[model samples]
Target: MPRRHLHVTGAAEAPLRAALRALRTELAVPDAFPLQVLVEAEHAAKAPRLPSYDATDLPLFTIDPPTSTDLDQAMHLSRRPGSGSASGAGPGGYRVRYAIADVAAFVTPGSALDAEAHRRVSTLYFPDGKVPLHPACLSEGAASLLPAHTCPAVLWTLDLDADGRTESVDVRRALVRSRAKLNYAGVQKEIDAGTAEEPLALLKEIGQLRERLEVERGGISLTIPEQEITEHADGETGGGTYELTYRAPLPADGWNAQISLLTGMAAADLMLAHGNGVLRTLPAAPDGAVGRLRRTAEALRIDWPHHVSYARLIRSLDPHDPRHAAFLQECTTLLRGAHYTPFRDGDLPTITTHSAVAAPYTHCTAPLRRLVDRYASEICLAAVAGTPTPDWVLAAFDTLPDEMTEGGRRAGRVERECVDLVEAALLRDRVGEVFEGFVVDVEDVEDVEDANEDQPVTGTVQLESPAVVGRVTGTPGTPLPLGERLRVRLTQSEPGAAKVRFVPVVPVDPVDPA
Candidate 1:
């Protein structure tokens, strides 16, 4: 790849320059309210305590991404094959327990820390860094499930069969001390090499069970590839490196599957027991997905099965090939918006369990990074301990949906803005340069029912194919189908707009379509 720098000598009257500077300043100091005072207030406020168990004896471990520090849950899975448990292939089967961190114990309700946590509500992931929900001193240290540090946790012991069905479950509050901290890549490598450690063996077994369950259920999802941008030393007078990376399925997805299954099972149990609670939600695939997918499949010349598993299809696609970019882009349309809302007396007729996990799920893994998890953990703690639920915790149940929904939106906006800024910056210096690109997606215009008669038209774009969407410019009136070859001229480049619109160039002697 040819390396080039995009300079930011803004045009004489570019409004973007001012906007970019203002955004830069905002990014400089992430808005984190002071939390120490709240921490003190929480400690001082008297509250009912749930009886604690000395589970520090049971060994636990946490596995996560390399850069993750706000550790939430931990696990230790053991098999009881001949111990009278079902073979685990059918319902009423028997499997050992999977434990998670009980965050509520450390963070008392109504504390300053709790208040600050509610305000932040979730973690903000910027390319440069993150704005943590809890202070590192606590999230990564005191409250974290770091090995050898005894911490209170909400533990779920699920009994399952060979087919990955949960027969029975037990939730409780226990004091735990993790045995080790493993990263996803390293553990995955170990699993791939067939050199399994004790923990990896258990993790593998649990992952297999979860995978089986997900495939059986109608949980459809896509394995979208993400690009990582780093400052390359020689690129811009010694800045960083920008590289596109993909995660292998094993241990990365496997590890996530284990945690998600654990959390989902726990969430389901809580919701079932309470008769009502706010659920983490995502709607089913959109209405036009099937037709759009058929068109995309035709564009790529890939067969679409009469019965399709979105996750299975995605697993078959290659992210390294630019050809797959457009396909993945096309898949984005199928994802419904994720939201949170409260439900009383099992009012939610249509449960919006996560589509990826194929089960009832909630945000309970990373309390230190998300506001909702803290309260959810508390609910689980109270229910498991059979203790009277705390007043503040109950109140959190009612308000968490609104806070979490808002937090999610904020996080998405911040992430998109950051990516736009960087991509725009990268393209600012490449104005007027021509590059070969692909036609990754295309859409048809449509009208919608409008309440206001003044404006009754709304046009939506659909993805044409599963290929890389690229910008081309030079000439007009040329047809560019998915997977078609094209060269384009870059007329205008606006980093702020993240805009690199191009016009298709036509050859002197064009081949007619058959």
Candidate 2:
């Protein structure tokens, strides 16, 4: 649920892009695909392995950000023939057919492209651009599930009962085409206007039902507002300026996400049945964490009745509200412990479930971008086909977990650094200015040997405008007031160090040294 989408405009765009390029070098992740990998990808794009079964006429369509080129999934939704009766006939079910890009079909084991994917692990999306897992020739070309473009894929057919519970699943390699490529805003607009067709309307209906099912299953999904940078062009100066803002996610975003979650759950179920595969796991939150959150709600002055569960409480809050945003930010603590767990040959890990999902889950949805999904797809295929999981894939069980962990670490490093750099840049010119913000998180600096009991502690402050979150502290021996709006003066803004600091404003300015 932690998300950041970057945007650049004006003079800052060039400098930010340059800084990002430098940061990529510092992180040791190259900006372009390796020559050998690109060559292999190109060859694979033109003449590679293909699937036998074809389902191009299923009227499947893709939904993604308008700029997404390495499209990974396409789906077709429809009502199952019958289910409302005792004999199991009439409105009792829905069928969701999802198509995922078949990256494994093109990247042969031990090939240059395959090795490169293992090294990259996953696509690294930065503020300006992305370091893709595979070359464009493969990721954005032949293998991409572009609209009207047939591609090799793993097609998943999920049959769900009236309550949106998946009753059965079928998955296999197939050649499929996405009839149309749609964006969330457009589809949502149609839905809101009551002009949506069956496919689009069904997304809302089933997405809502699946959501209800999730709550019943005790799942948690944080609709964390996305922090984004936007640029506004200056007319007279012929330049642009940047502003960081928090954009609440649209309902369509969650609806589409539920479908992917459904697929991951199905994949996890398949692997567990066969006693093999990697699970996206998370240890359940400690019992006291909920107590802490209730306290957080109290601090933020939001009512939390004793009988209402955290999931329900979360759904009840409107993220656009500052107090609710602060609460949601606090809620991320419950899911911070998630990780990938792998096992094989009936050797299941002790923690087989993802706490946030409250269900067994795997990452099998986005094969084009994630290395693990390619492997998970292979496992799920073998599990369903009654064939042995590929030798290469089985062997990867040893290192894939570490590989994914390292990959995620690198991505996080880049993201944190990118934000630090941009936030510093945005505040550099106003280092001595004060901004209004609310404290969303607080961390107690341990009572050290020389420190006092009431020593000032650090906390995160969400700025009311420009939407930046930075460190804020109080005067010595005074912790920053939590969950309350206060004017914090920007005391330090060092772009080179990618650091920024703020402190509660003094009522009166100090005497000028000059």
Scored by TM-score, the top model is 2
Q: How accurate is candidate 1 locally (lDDT)?
A: 0.57
lDDT per residue for candidate 2 within 313-407, as digits (tens), equals: 99898889988988997898898777888888888899999988999999999988899999999999999998888999988888888999999
Cα lDDT tens digits, model 1, 1-514, are 0011112332333444454555646655346557675455345223323336777777777777666666787777655454333453332334545556555656667777677778777767655456677666666766678888876667777766554556666777777788888887787777777886765665776667666566667554454455444433343333332332332234456545655656665675676577555567666766577577777777766666868666777757765555565577577666647666555554663765765556667766666677776666666666665665557766766677777877776766666565455554445566666555555554332323433434322211111221112343222233345554444445555555554455554461222323
Query: What is the Cα root-mean-square deviation between model 1 and the actual structure?
Result: 6.7
What are the C-alpha RMSDs, in order, of all predicted structures?
6.7, 3.9
TM-scores of the candidates are: 0.78, 0.93
Compared with the true structure, all predictions reach lDDT values of 0.57, 0.84
List the lowest-lDDT window of 10 residues for candidate 1: 459-468
Tell me how candidate 2 scores on lDDT. 0.84
